[model samples]
Target: MKIDDLRKISVIGSGAMGSQIAMVCALSGYQVTLQDIQFESLEKAKALLNSQMNKRIVKGKLTEQVVEEAFARLSFTTDLKEAVSDTDFVIEAIVEKLDIKRQLFAQLDQLAPPHTILATNSSTIVSSEIAPATNRPEKVCNMHFFNPALVMDLVEVVQGPHTSDETAEITMALSKRLNKTPILLQKEISGFVANRILGKIMNEAIYLLENEIATAEEIDLACTKALNHPIGPFALIDLTGLDVHYNVRMERYAKSGDEADKPSSLIVEKVERGELGRKTGQGFYAYN
Candidate 1:
C-alpha cells in the first residue's frame, strides 16, 4: 500500500519507546492507538505523553493548540483485538524476548487487516526470525527507533529476508512524515548497523572496566573530549540502561561470531544485580 493510504497506526507495548512513537504518529496527523497488556500501563503512557507535550510547550517548542490536537489524535487501549482491529500499520515495541515477540505477531497476524503492515522497534532481534511468526511475512520488517523516540531523529528501516519492496518504501515514507532521518538497512545483520557498531564499542569498554584499566569517568571523558562524541560509550550505556546494554550484548555474543563481541563477565554480574542505569538510578556510575 502507498504510504498516504496509511491513516491509522497502532503501537504495541506502552513503554517509553511505544509511547513516544504514538506521540510522533499523532503529531504527524495519523490516528494512533497505543496498546499494552495492562490498562494502567496505557494510562501511564498517556500521562507521560501529556507531560512531555507540556514540557515542549513550556519550552516554546510547540504551541498549546498543537498539544491539544496531538492528544485528540491519540488513544490508548488494553484490548489487543481492538487495538489491532482497523490499523493501517502496527509497530511492535514490546519486550526484547523473541518468544514474546513471536506470540504477539501471531496475534497481530490474525487480528489486523489483511494489508496492514507489521513493523518491529526491536534493536537486536533479526527481522527474519520475527517475520515467520506472521502470516504476511512480506509485510513484516524492522523499524528500529532510538530511545526516547519522540526526540531521536535517526530511524533504521530494516528489510527482512521476506520483506516486500512496498513495505520498505511505505515505512521510509512514514518515517519521513514523522520528520525522522530514515536509514535503510538492506540486510538483516545482527544489531542492524548502529547497534552492532555500538555493541562492539560497549563490549570493549566493559572489558577495560573489568580489567581495572580505566574508570567510567575516564572512559566517558575520552569519548567526549578526545573523540568528540556527544556521549561516551559508558554514559550512553548507562542512559540506555546497563541491563539493556548487557542483554543485547549477550544476544550479539551468541550470534556475533566474534569472540570480542561476547559480553564481559562483569557486565553480566552488574545487570544480574539490577543496576539498570538511568532508569534504575544506577549503573557504571551511580545516578543516585
Candidate 2:
C-alpha cells in the first residue's frame, strides 16, 4: 500500500522505543494503537508520553494544541489481535529474543490483513531471522530506530533476502512521513550498520575498563572532548540501560561462541545488583 493510503498504525510494545514510536506516529497525524500485554507498562508509557510532550511544549518545540491532537489520535490496548486487526502497518518493538519475535510475527501474520506491512525495530537481529516464522516474508523487514525514537532522526530501513522492494519503499516513505532520515540497507547484517560500528566502540571501551587502562569517566571524556561525541560511552550505556547492552552481548556470544562477545564483568555485576541505568537510577554512574 502507498504511504498516504496507510492510515492506522500499531506499535506492538509499550517499552521505551515502542511508546516513543507510537507518539511520533500520532504526532504525524496517524491513528496509533499502542499495545502491551501488561496494563502497567501501558500506563507508564502514557505517563512518559505526557511528560515528554509537556517538556517539548515548555521548550517551545511543540504547541499544546499539537500535543492534545496527538494524544487524541493515540490509544492503548492489551489485546494484540484487536490492535493489529485494522492497522495498515505494524511495527514490532518487543523483546530482542529471536523465538519470542518469531512467535509474535507468526501470530501477527495470521491476525493482520494481507496488505499490512510487518516491520521489526530490532537493533541486532536481522529481519531474515524473523521472517521465516511467517508466510509473507516479502512483507517483513527491519526498521531500526535509535533510542529516544522521538528525537533521533536516523531510522535504518533493512531489507532481508525475502523482503520485496515494495516493502522497503513503503517503509522508507513511512519513515520520511514521520520526519525521520531513512537509510535503506540492501543486505541484512547482524547489528546492521550503526550498532555493528557502535558495538566495536563499546567493546573497546569495556576492554579499556577491564584492563585498567582508563576510568569510565576518563574514557567517556576522551570520546566526548577528543572524538567530539555528544554523549560518552558510559553515559550512553546508562541511557540505553546496562541490562540491554549485556543482553545483546550475551546473545552475540551465544551465536559466535567468542569470549570477547560476552558481557563485560562490570556490566554483569551491575545487572545482578539491579543497577540497570537511568531507569533504575544507577549503573556505571548514579542518577538523581
Top-TM-score structure, candidate number: 2
Query: Candidate 1: global Cα-lDDT?
Result: 0.87
* Clash pairs, model 2 backbone: none
| Stretches of candidate 2 exceeding 4 Å from the true structure | none
Estimate candidate 2's alpha-carbon lDDT, on a 0 to 1 scale.
0.93
Q: How many clashes in each structure?
A: 0, 0
Residues 1-288 of candidate 2: C-alpha lDDT, one tens digit per residue? 788799999999999999999999999999999999999999999999999999999999999999999999999999999999999999999977888999999999999999999999998888898899999999999999999899899999998899999999999999999999999999987888888988888988988998999999999999999999888889999998888888788878878999988898889999999999999999889899
CA shift at 264, candidate 1, in angstroms? 2.1
lDDT of 1 by residue, 1-288 (tens): 898799999999998889999999999899999999998888888888889999999999999998899899988898999998999999999877788899999999999999999999998887798888878999999999998788888999998779999999999999999999999988888688887777677767777877899998998898799989888998887777776666676666677677766667777777899887887888877876
lDDT of each: 0.87, 0.93
